[model samples]
Target: MISPRVNTRVWQRSISLLSPQAAKTESNVVTKERTYIENLSKDIATSRFRLVDENGKIASITVQPDIPICIKKDCLVSIHNLNHLSLSYKWLNFWSNLIKFRSFKSSLFHRIIGSSVLEILAAPNFQTSRRPFDSSRSLSVLNLTGTKDWNVFGKDSIIAFEQNSSLEIKSPIFPSARSLVSNSSKSQLPRKFQILNGRGNVLVCGGGLVYSIELIDESDKILVNSRNILAINGQ
Candidate 1:
C-alpha cells in the first residue's frame, strides 16, 4: 500500500550509460536530464506528500479526499489538509466501563460549558505518546473490503477502526460452565465475553508479540487464550 512510484528517468539514464555506443548523444542526454528535472518539480508541487512517524513507527499515507482512516488515540504524528477531515470517537462497547467513564467525563465537560454536546480537537501544539510498555505491543494494520461480516475479539484488543464500522458486545457461549472449569483456583470469573463486529481497516493492539493462524476447518480450530486474541478476520 505504501510503495513509491518508480521514476522512469533513472532507468533511461542507466540504460544510456550502460551502452558502449551512445544510445543517446551527450547533448540529448543533457536535454533529457533537464526535462526530467522540470517534470519532477511539477510532480512535487502538484502531488506533495509526507510520511509521519512517531516513536519510530511510520504511518505512510498520502493525504487524499474522502478516504476514511482510523488511527489509534495518541498515535498520530502529523496530518495534512486538516480542514478536509473529521474526527470522532468510534464507540466499541457502550456497556464497557471504559465507555461509561468517557461518557461521564464528556457530560461533565458539556455541563460546565452549558452545551448539549461538546466536541474537542487537539491544539496545534498539543502532543502525546504511547507508554513504553504499550509501544512494545505490536500494531497490526488490516485492509478490509467489507466482505467478511463476523469478527470475534477479546476485551481491549481493538485499538481503532473506521467510523462506519460497528462493534458490539458478543458472548460466544454461556460462561457458567466455562467459569466452573476455568475458575476453580480463583474466587470468581467474568461471566461474559466481548467481541467486535465490523468490516473495514482496523488497527488492533496485541497484548504482546502477535501472530496469526489460519482456521482451515472446524477440526483445525485452535483455542486462543482470551487475552492473546488481537483480531479475527472472517466469519
Candidate 2:
C-alpha cells in the first residue's frame, strides 16, 4: 500500500514529464529588417518630394506642386495638371552639355506642370545585366537645408530639383592648372559639375544603387570612383 503523499508525488512527476511546456511568445518581436529605401521614404514623407519606387532597376519620384520642380523631359511619365500646374521649357547648358556629355537629353529642360502631381521614372538600359555589384544606376533624393552647396555629377542623372533651388553648371576645379591640363586627355573626367544651392529637395538618378554615406569630419574621408559618384556635399 503506497502512502497518499508518495502517490501524489509520483502523479505530479509523471504529469510534468508527459506534458509539453508552453512557448513564451513576444508580441513586440520584429521578424524582418526594414530596407533603407523605406527609411528614406519616412524621412521625407512630409516634404513635397517623395520617393515612390527605388527597387534597384526602376526608380520613380512623385512631386507635389507646392513649388515648381525641374525635371528631365525624357523621365516624365505622367502628370496631373487639371488646372493647377504649368509646364515650360528652358535651355540649360544647351550647347556645352550637348558637346561635352555627347547626349542631347540633358540639354533640354522641362518644368513642373501647373498645380499638378508629377511622376518621374528612370529605367537604365543596362539594369538587366548580371553584374554582382552594380550600384551605379539608381535614384536618390537629397534634402537641402540652405546651408552647404552640393556638387552633382552627370547632369543627365539629375531627374529633378525644386524650382526654388539654384543650379549652376561649372567646370571641375583642379588643384592646379598643370593637373587640369594633364587630365584633359582623360575621358573619365567630367566636363562639367553642376553646383546646387538653396533649400529644397533634389531627385537624382544613378546607374545602379543609390545610397548615402556620411563623413563625420575632415578625418572621415573616402575615395570613390568619379564615375560612380552621384552627388557630394560642397562643404
Candidate 3:
C-alpha cells in the first residue's frame, strides 16, 4: 500500500491568504467605530446642554424660553438675555424679599420666559448634581397642574420652574409632643416646606444624584430621612 503525504505547505499558504483579510476587516470595524464616536461628540457639542467633560458632566446649560430653567443664584456663571426673556424671582421669605440678598430676593430664579432663547452657565465652583425628576429613582420634578400639590423641603435647592407655577412658603408643621420630646435631633423636626403647584416643569438642585421612589398603593410606605428629602408629592 502507498502512503500519501499531507501537504503542510498548502495549509500554511491558506492561513497566510486569510490573515490579511481578517486584519483588514478588523481595521475597518475600528475606523467605523472611531467615526461614529466623533460624530456623536459633535452632536453633543452643538446640543442645548453640552457636557463639558467626557464623563457626561454638564458645566453649562442653555435655557430656551419654551423650556425655562431655574438655577441657584451662586451657580450662575453668566446670563445672556439677548431675546429679553422675562426674568423674575420669588421670595423665599418676607425677610429675603425685604433684604434682597445678592440683589435678588430668593436664591433661585426663572431665567427664561416668552419667545426667545437664553444662555446660562454653571459656576466653576458649583458642584450640585442635576438630574431630571424621576419618581422611581427618588427624583422629583416640579410640575403643577393646580390639581396636585408638592411639598418641597426647602427653597434653597429649587433651581427653576415654569413661569405659571406658584410657590407658597409655609411654616413647618408642628411636631407632636411625643416627637418633640423623643426626637433629640432638632434637624429631624420640620422647619419649613415650600408648597409648590403649577402647570410647568421645575428644576431642583440636589446635593448628590437626585433619585425618587414611588408608592404604588396605600400599603406601600417608606420612611425617609427629612434632611435627604428633596420633595414629596402631596397627591
> Top lDDT: which candidate number?
2
- Between candidates 2 and 3, the one scoring higher on TM-score is 2
Q: What is the lDDT of residue 71 in candidate 1?
A: 42
Of 1 and 2, the candidate ranking higher by TM-score? 2
Report the error of model 2 at residue 123, Å: 5.9
Model 2 error, position 84 (Å): 4.5
Clash totals in order? 0, 15, 10
- Over 4 Å off, model 3: 1-70, 78-92, 96-115, 119-140, 165-189
Estimate, for each residue in 25-51, the C-alpha lDDT of model 3 and write its tens digit.
334433563455456545432114433
Clashing pairs in 1: none
Q: Which regions of candidate 2 deviate over 4 angstroms?
A: 1-47, 54-66, 116-136, 165-191
Q: TM-score for model 2?
A: 0.59
lDDT value for candidate 3?
0.45
Error of 1 at 199 (Å): 3.1
- Residue 104 error, candidate 2, Å: 3.2
**Tens-place lDDT digits, model 2, residues 113-168:** 44556554544433234552244555566666555777777757676665652434
Model 3: how far residue 75 lies from native, Å: 2.0
RMSD of 3: 19.3
